[model samples]
Target: MLVRIITGIIGITAAAFVIQTGGVVFAGFTLLLMLLAWFEYVRAFSERGMGIALVTGFIALAAMWYAAWQKPELLALACPLIVLVMLLESVLMRGSTSIMDALASGAGLIYIGFPFTCLLQLRGMLPETVFSTEISSFTFGCAFVWIMFIGTWASDTFAYFTGTAIGRHKLCPSISPNKTIEGFMGSVIGTTAVVAGLGYYLNLPLQEMAVLGLLIAIFATLGDLVESVAKRYVGIKDSGNIIPGHGGVWDRFDSVLFTAPLVFYFVQFVNLLGK
Candidate 1:
């Protein structure tokens, strides 16, 4: 508990600073997290003798990142190429690497990398991106980011307390035994409440922000569960031990992975509808 509290404080503080920055710097922060998460991801498999191509994995990430930064259109092209490269590497060295290894490695480069890219796109880092009309306003990006992070935080905090107090049934005993149905309820309701409360002040539509919060809570839970399942498959307790209590960047920021994309698309769709 002590370790968790300490880590939470430091993490929240750092995240606040980065999100507040809201530009290429914030994108860099997101990229750093993705890179760390990706490294831990591939390392987990490699340790299990998966023989993942580490150099190629990083090169793929770099290429994809460059595309997102320099040529957003090339992003689509880079993604499939990443998977193809990994598969080809495995095929050429079948004795060392397996087809499954290539698939997993390739997916990681996208799964971990793409969300961060979404975050970048969400923050309007790329040209002619996000908030269709408010091109120069970081408010559009920062406010949405606030929605995702705060909603996810509310979900985790409320779920922990709510679960401990009244949780009776396991939510997903197979993947994450500690999760409870009561906790899920708390997360969704609590996150929605918090987001609706703040969203109004942020100039977002209250009804829509409430819905976004609910969706964030749901997707955040799914993200955490997915990461848990991945770790279980890798036969590891946590992705890595970068955090004293939390585990790795993935274990810490897993909730944001899905929610970032969720918020980006939700906002864009909302904007389109408003038009």
Candidate 2:
């Protein structure tokens, strides 16, 4: 428990620093995480004899992210191009790499690459001019990203304690035996309270923040469960031993990966509605 608490604090501190940095530094941080996540991902799936080409995978991953960052319009082309590249490689290798294995490699690119790129999008997305009069667009963008991070982290943290204390009924016993219905409720309530408070304090839209908080809790739980299922299937306890008492980059960012896209589009929808 102590180790978990200490790790959480350290992690949060580092996260705060980079979030505030919010430029090339944050981009570099996100790239480093995506690379670590890719490493863990390939290593985990290797158990099933999926021999993903590491060099090709990295190139495709970097290309996809570049499209997302600099050329949003090119993403449609980039995705299919990646799949085509994977398929070609698999065909060339014939007996060495199955088509299923090739598809899984593409799936990993989408699963890890797209969501990680959304973090950049959310951080860089500027708000409407009306709202920007009060708060700088840069500051507002940073706050939105903060809400995403905090909402997911709070949901996961409270769920654990709440489940341990008053958990009776199982939520998903097969995927994660420790999860409980009570804990799920706790996550929803706790995430709402914390995020609403943050939203109000930040002069953000309280109503939207409240709704986003609920969405984050729901999706964050689902995200954790999805990763848990993958790990269970892969016969691994943790994704990697990178982060002490917390598993790995994949484990730490799983909930954020799920919530990042949610918060990004939610805020954009809000901007549209306001306009």
Candidate 3:
């Protein structure tokens, strides 16, 4: 418990620092994170003796993330380019590649690439490019990303303690036997409370915060379950042992993978509707 708590604090501090900087600093940090996460993901597959085009996938992942950051409008073309590269790689190695291997490679890119790209896009939602002085500071955009992180962490923490204490019914026996329905409820309530409380400081409407919090909670749980399923399929317990107590980047940011994109679009939708 001590180790886990310490690691959590360090992680949160690092995240806050990068978020506040909010530009190449954050983008560079996220890119490094994506690389580590991609490595851990491929390493997990490699453990099962699965063959994939690591070089090509990494290139595509980096390219897509760059596009999302520098040119949000290019995402439409970037995604198809990734698939095309994956297919081309498969064909080029036809004699050695199996259909399952090819499929896994594609899935791996989408799983790791898309969500991380969404994070870049979310961070890039400032009034202008990172160089612009129109806003003078990244107060709003930074706060949005921070809240997404806080809400996700709150849900996971609450669910862990709640489930540990009095959890009864299994949430998903096959994928994650330890998760409980009670924990799920605790996660939702905890996330909502935290977001709503922070709303005032963030200068966001309480009602909007409530809805965002609920959505984050629900999607974060789904993200955890989906990751559990992937790990189970790969026959591994934790994604990696990079962090002493937190497992890996994937293990830590799985919830963010789902929640970031959802919140980004939701915020966009709300703004459009309000206007």
Candidate 4:
């Protein structure tokens, strides 16, 4: 418990510092994380001796990184290529393998790569009309991203303590035995509180903050379940033991993987509605 709290504090602090720096620092850090995540993901599938899985994983990562940085145009081009490659590979390996391998690889790419890239894109999507000042725009963009992280983390922490203390009903025993309905409610409440506080500080609309909080809570829970399902399928307790208490990079960012894109889209939608 102590290890987890310490790790969580350190991770949040470091992430906030890097995010506040913005520009190359944030981009480079995010890219490096995505690459490492892709590596771990491919390594997991490769253990089952699926060579094509690794290839497709890297291809997906590369496409995502490129799309995040340079050309959103290429994503359309990349998606069909990924689909074709996966289909062809599945056909060629039909006699030798199960379709689960291909599905796992594809799922990881969409699960991890898509949101990671979307976050990068979010950083780039600041409105030129809002500010002539680059620093102000970057700071505003980073603030939105930071709020998402803070709310998600608060929700997870609340769920953990509440579930441990008072959990009686299993939320999804088949997927994650430890998760409970009490925990889910705790998470929602915690997330809502944090969202309300941050939204007031940032002057975001009350309704938007309420909705964002709910979405973050829902997506974060789903993300945790998705990772749990993956680990259960692979017969592993944790993705890796890199962090002393957190299990792995994926373990630490599981919620972020799912919530980031959702938050990004919410911001975009709000911006559009405002105009």
lDDT of 4 by residue, 150-243 (tens): 8888889889999999999999999999999999999998898788777766666777888788889989999999888877766778777777
Better of 2 and 4 by lDDT: 2
* Top model number, lDDT: 2
Give lDDT for model 3: 0.82
Residue 61, model 4: Cα distance from true site in angstroms: 0.7
Rank the models by TM-score, top first. Answer: 3, 2, 1, 4
- Model 1: how far residue 239 lies from native, Å: 1.4
Q: Itemize residue pairs with steric clashes in candidate 3.
A: none
| Per-model lDDT | 0.80, 0.83, 0.82, 0.77
Ranking of predictions according to lDDT: 2, 3, 1, 4
Per-candidate Cα RMSD to the true structure, in Å, reads 3.6, 2.7, 3.3, 3.2
Q: Which residue segments of model 1 deviate by more than 4 Å? A: 125-138, 272-275
lDDT tens per residue, model 2, 34-149: 88898898999998777876777788878877776788789779888888888887889988888888988888878888888888877777643223335343366687788788
The sequence of per-residue lDDT tens digits that candidate 3 reaches over residues 1-275 is 89988987887788878888878999998888888888888888887788877777778888888888888789889887777767776678888776667788877788778888887778767544222234334455666787788899898988999999989999999989999999999999999989988775545678888888899999999999989988998899899888878899899888888998887888777852233
Over 4 Å off in model 4, which ranges? Answer: 1-6, 46-52, 91-99, 127-138, 271-275
How high is each candidate's TM-score? 0.90, 0.91, 0.92, 0.87
lDDT, model 3, position 223? 91
Candidate 2 residue-pair clash tally: 0
Candidate 4: global Cα-lDDT? 0.77
